[model samples]
Target: EEAGEHVLEVEVSLPELAELLGEELRLPAIRPRGREAVLSDVRRYRSIRRTGPESLRHFRRTFRTALRRQIAEGTYEPDRPVVVPRREDRRYRSWRIAEVPQSNAAVIYMMDVSGSMGTEQKEIVRIEAFWIDTWLRSQYRNIEVRYIVHDAAAREVDRHSFFHLRESGGTKISSAYELCSRIVEERYSPMEWNVYPFHFSDGDNWSGGDTRTCMELLREKLLPRVNVFCYGQVKSAYGSGQFKVDLDDELGDDGRVLTSEIPDREGILPSIRTFLGTGR
Candidate 1:
C-alpha cells in the first residue's frame, strides 16, 4: 500500500485583487507623464552566463550543457538516463541593473466626519477607499496616501483615526479642500507626482457661501494641479443631498472633475468605476 498526502492552502495578494477589480470594471491603464528619473535600481536576470555564484546558478541550462557534452563524447547511456556536469559544463544567471522611472503618486482622501455621517456611511467610505488604494497602487510603482476628516473644521489624521473618529458640527467642505491644496503645494509637486484627491461626503455644506468657496478652491487651486478630482456623495438620512446637484450644475462639463452618488453598499462598485474609469 502507498501512503497519500492531502493539503489545503489559501493565499491573498493585493495585486491580484487589483487585477480582479480592473477586469470587473473594464478599467483602462493609466498613462504616466513626467521626466524619467532613476528612483530605484532593479536587478533583472535576463541572460545565462558560464560563471556566477552558486546561488545564481541556472539548473536547466547547466543540465542541458552537461547532457549535450556527454552525448557528443559518447559518455551518456540512453538506458541509464544519467547526466553529470563537469566543471566547464556549469551555467549561471547574469543580471543587469534596470533603472526604474520615478512615476510616483499621492492619494489624498478627505471625508465628512460631521454628525450626519453615520457609522454605516463611514463603513461605505472605508470599503471604497480600500478598492481605490488597491487600484491606484497597481498603476504606480510608488504611492502615498494621506487622510483628512472634517466637520466645520478639517484636520489631517492617521489612517486609523481617519476612518474611526467621529465629530459633531456643521459641514464646511471648503476647509478640507483648502487643507488639501496646502498639502499639495507644500509637499507634492504636480510636476513630479501624480496627485489624486478623493472626497466623500453626504452632500451637506454649512452654507451656499461655503459651497462657493469650495467651488473656487476646486477651480483655481485643485483642478489644474491634480490628475482628477473625485467627489463621492454617500447618502444619509439626515443629509439633504444638495452638494452633488450643485457640483453637477457648476463643474459637470469639466473633464478633470468626477462625481458619483453612493446610495449604499451596492453603489460602491459603480462609484469606483466612475471615479477611476477615466484612467487619469
Candidate 2:
C-alpha cells in the first residue's frame, strides 16, 4: 500500500527558472534620465604616437615599413633575415573616460526578524532574494541593493547580516516599512532610479494598529516613488498569517503592489515569479 501511494515531484532547473522568468516577466529596460553622465574608462588605439610602450606596438605595419626601408637603403640581406623596428614603430593604447548615461535600479529588501519567523522562513526569503537580484540586475546597467531587518524595531544591515539575522522579540511591521520609505525618498529618487522595495515576513504583526501603519506607509509614501512594492509572506508555524489577508483587504486591485505566499523553500521561485510578473 505504501509503495503504491507515491506522488510525482517535479524538479525545477536553474536554467529553466531564468528562461521562465524571462517569459513571465517582461520588464522594460530602464533608460537613465539625468544630466550627469556616468564615466567609463575605455582604451583606444586611434592615435599612434612616435614613442610608446612595447605592448601596443603595430607589429605588422612596423614590419612592412622596416622591410621597405631596409630594401631601399641597401641594408636588406636575403642571405641573413633580420628586420628591426625603430622607436616610431611602438604604439600604446590610450585610455580615456567616456561619459554615458544608463538606467539605474535599486532593490530594498526588508524582512521580519521577529521570533515567530523561523530559520526556514528566512531561508525562503534568501532564496527568493537571490533570484530577484539576478533578474533585476539583468534588466538594469546599474543596480543597488539594501537590506533592512525588523523585530519590534528595524535597522539597516549588510547583506551577510540581513539573511543570517535570527528571530527575536515581537513583530512591528511598521518599523521596517518606515525605514524602507525613508531609503526610497533619500537615496533612490523616482525620477533617477527604478526602485523596487520588497518585504518578507510570516504575516504576523504586533497588532492591527501596526499593520495600519504599514498600509499607510505603503499607500502614501512608498508606492508613489517605487516601481513596485513586493511582499512575500512566508508561512511559519508560530505565525498568525493574518497580515497577508490584511494587505489584501486594504490594498485592493493595486497593480503596483504584489504579494506572494511562500509556503517553503520550494515556493521561493513561484513567489518571485508572481511578485515580478506584473512587469511594473
Candidate 3:
C-alpha cells in the first residue's frame, strides 16, 4: 500500500473550471435580463449600380446595356450586330451598417475585511469568485466586474486589492451595501444590464441597527434593481456571525436575495451551488 500513503494532484484549465463549476453547482445558463445595443456591418446584394469592382460586375445587366446601346446608336449592323460591354455598364452590390440589440451582464463583488475575516475566508472568497466568474462570463456576451471592501467603512478597490487588503477595525456591513447600491445606480442600469451582486463576510457587524439598514437597502434599492443579490457568510472564530441569521429571518426565502454559509474552503463549492443553483 506504499507505506499507507497517498497523494493527489489537481490541475484545471479555464474551460474545465467552467464546466466543473456548472456541474457542481447545477447552475442554469443565465439569460441576461436586459438588452444591449450592438452595431453590425451587414453586407447584402440589396442594390445594383453600374459602377463597382470587376468581381462584383453583373454579367446579365452589363450585356443588356451593351446591346441596348449598340441598337439605339445605329451601330448594330444586321449582318454583324456586335456588342461590347464598357466599364459604365458594370454593376455591383453594396452593404450597410445595422444596429442590433443584444444582452449583457455585470457582477459586483463585495467583502468584509474586518480582522475577523482572515486569510482562510479570503481564500475561500477568491476561489469561489473565480468559478462564479467563469460561469457568468460564459452566460453573457459582455460582462463587467466591480470590487468593494469594507471594515468600518467601504471603499472601491481593484481586484487585487479586494482579495489582499487587510484592516483591523469594527465591522460595518451596511457601508459595503451602501457603496454597492450607489455603484449599481450610477454605472449599471437595471433596465439595460443584468446586474448581479455578491457579498462575503464573517457575519459580524457593529450593531443590529446597521444590519437593519443593510436589509432596507436590499429590499428597496438593490432587490428591485438587480437580477440577483447573493450573500455568503464565512465562519470565523472571532466573529459573532449574527448577520446571516438576521438576513434569513427578515428576507425569508425571497427569490431575489440568496444566502449561503461557507464554513471554510471545503464549503466553497457547495455555497456556490446554494447561491446560484436557482438560476436567477
Please list the C-alpha lDDT of all candidates, in the order they appear: 0.89, 0.77, 0.81
Residue-level error in angstroms, candidate 1, position 159: 0.4
Q: 149-220 in candidate 1: lDDT tens per residue?
A: 999999999999999998988899999999999999898888788999999999999999999999999999
Q: Which regions in candidate 3 have their CA more than 4 angstroms from the true location?
A: 1-13, 37-102
How many clashes (backbone N, Cα, C below 3 Å) per candidate?
Answer: 0, 0, 0
Q: Which predicted model would earn the best TM-score?
A: 1
Q: Give candidate 2 regions above 4 Å deviation.
A: 1-20, 23-101
**Model 2 over residues 14-100: C-alpha lDDT tens digits?**
433554567665543334443322544444244445566767565655666777878888997766667876665444444444332
Q: What ranking of all candidate models by lDDT puts the best one first?
A: 1, 3, 2
RMSD per prediction, one decimal? 9.6, 15.3, 18.5
Residue 90 of model 3: what lDDT?
66
lDDT of 3: 0.81
Better of 1 and 2 by TM-score: 1
Candidate 2 has its poorest 10 consecutive residues by lDDT at 1-10
